[model samples]
Target: MRQEKLKYLAKLALLVLMGIFGSFLISEAGLRLMNISYPVFHGFDPVRGRILEPGMEGWFRYEGNAYVKINSAGFRDVEHPLQKPKGTYRILLLGDSYTEARQVSLENTFGRKVEQQLQSCERLLPHLVEVINFGVPGYGNAEELITLRSRGWAYDPDLVLTMFFSGNDLIDNFPRAELREPAYIPRPYFHLDQGELKLAYNFQEWSPPILKYRLLLWGVHNFRTLELLNQANRVLAARHIGDSQENLSSRAGLADFVYAPPQTPIHREAWDITEGILKLMHQEVLKHGANFFLVTATSPDQIDQEERILLKERLATKKLDYPEQRLRALGEIEGFPVLNLLYDFQQYAEQHPAHLHGFSNTKLGAGHWNEQGHELAAQLISKRICQDPSIL
Candidate 1:
């Protein structure tokens, strides 16, 4: 009787396992059939640190619902030939997430908008213009320098545009030791040694196992079910840990340091490193025979009147525009043209009276640029390029 009971239990267990496996397969097939996928687009790169997963496509519905595709070159933009076709004027864009502009659709991104607008320019009427996006989220100038060296120059672009985001690029360039708070993602940093710039791999050296990263990436890439679960987990984690930067307090903390002048020794060092990196980038672009331009991205606090007032009241300073001023000054000194979008963005916001930075799902005027912001940015950038005969 005991043997019979054991056999029955074994049969039941087998049936349960089979049922679960069948259910998983069904769910996976159903998701695939419905063409639904979660955005798991980032992949680890030993050189650049983090890059968009090549040939990855999914529905980005976190901040806004839009389908995103990463070309086989790992750029968020459309595919292009590596060898520049004859009579083609290619522009390579390097920056952090602002250049990536994943919050909106690819067509709505400033890069695409700039490309579309420039197509009608009479200066280069016959030559086809292509703008390749080499932006990655959470990247600082350090990574951008590496990317320009390793990947960007290969395109043989006629112009290289670096979109500098003061919000975190200023803070993210320094070594982890100099930072007051630990960086959420470890990254390579550039440090000056005897007035020479050197790459420090402290972040990579101290990071967790690469195998773990590879496995997670593989799972997300191959399994739609895993992708959904991974996104859900991230959302849950953000909620539980209060990690989203959409809150007023978080923005205030960031603004206090970034919006103001370098108050501490670390802040000063960070600025030095940032400027050094930019200079190096300029030199490299010149060496490659391409014109370089730096554009400072607008911060929400810099545009939002209410947020600006609140920040000024909190920080006890009216000099919230220090970051843009520093970048403009740097461009002037370094002989590169700078299009400071802060003033224009501010003017647009005051006139139009709409949110440029954030969406309805997230706090308005607190995060990445919305569609209107990108549209305005494209207008300004294209106008600058068209007006400047040197770039042509």
Candidate 2:
């Protein structure tokens, strides 16, 4: 009996060791096959498969296309190690994912389109015009302000154009502990004091190099694992509101799943926070001797107001509120030039129905610009820039 027990114990120990070795081998093989490398936070390294520089420092791998840090501010493709040329007019473009050209290629981005147009012009003011794309995904006025203050001045921009999206930018600016780090990572902070909003640095804490490396390794080798973790996070986020019904809808046409937060009042304290961030951003732009222009984008709700209202009513029936009016009102405030593209895009879409072909038809999903959309944005923006004698 004793000899039989010993044999069983040895067999169990061998199985455990084999399992451990198997896991390690699988992880190592996965990393090797994927060619993954550790990405530096806030630094752009192209060799390691990192696209986009000087921001959150994560590998932006989507649809097999990669973007490394192009030296131009925002999303502009220009000569690296940017040197302000004697006769070049520098323009800095700032915004969120839409401005980052997430759904489109680098050359197809609006900033690149504008640059191409400017270069094509052989008329009098043809010395040289440089438009840099400083837009980062998930950034709001706070991050935009910080980026402008920190990096915009270096390029000596003659004009700074900031794009605002209604859906996420406001949410991005709100003071939430969940947005601290490792997820929804941001570089700026807003403080609300007695109805007044203040801006401050929120990026003091740094991720350890080893942890960052591990995350990179995991991100590359275990994408499915990270995806599962993200899904788990969404489930937790939904549970935070204690609501039975959830909007577990993903972005339109794309399989990427997103957790939709419970509807909150449009005029809630969040707008106050957003307003404060914008105020600081405007002031910062002026401080650098650069003119600021506010360009707005369309959300799906804005595309069909009646449908949005109905959706809001449904949420309201459930004791939830959506901050639609507050956002529009905030945009109306006096300060910089505001280009509300919601109305214009809707009108254009109505006239030319063909433009909607490339976009997803789902009303709940976010809309991306096709070639027409990009052209329209470029034309309107460029026309506005030319109209402003100050920018010239």
lDDT of 1 by residue, 20-75 (tens): 98988998999899987886888877787678889888777778556888999888
Task: Give the Cα-based TM-score of candidate 2 against the true structure.
Answer: 0.68
For model 2, which pairs clash? 51-67, 51-68, 73-133, 74-133, 74-134, 75-133, 75-134, 76-133, 266-323
Question: Where does candidate 2 have its weakest 10-residue lDDT segment?
Answer: 250-259
Q: Where is model 2 more than 4 Å wrong at Cα?
A: 1-79, 120-124, 177-187, 200-266, 304-334, 355-365
Error of 1 at 334 (Å): 1.2
Clashing pairs in 1: none
Model 1, CA-based lDDT: 0.83
Report every candidate's CA lDDT.
Answer: 0.83, 0.57
Work out the TM-score per prediction. Answer: 0.88, 0.68
| All candidates: CA RMSD (Å) | 3.6, 7.6
Number of colliding residue pairs in each model: 0, 9
| Tens digits of per-residue lDDT for model 2, 1-392 | 99999999999999999998787677567755775533322332212112244332234333213344444333435453457888887788888777876455567778888876776555418567788888766677777776776666888887788888766666566655343224323345576878777665433334464346446545633454344345456557756632322221121111111112323443355566776777677777788787877777756544554544565564444211223334445545745666666656667766764552134332123355655666788877777676655445
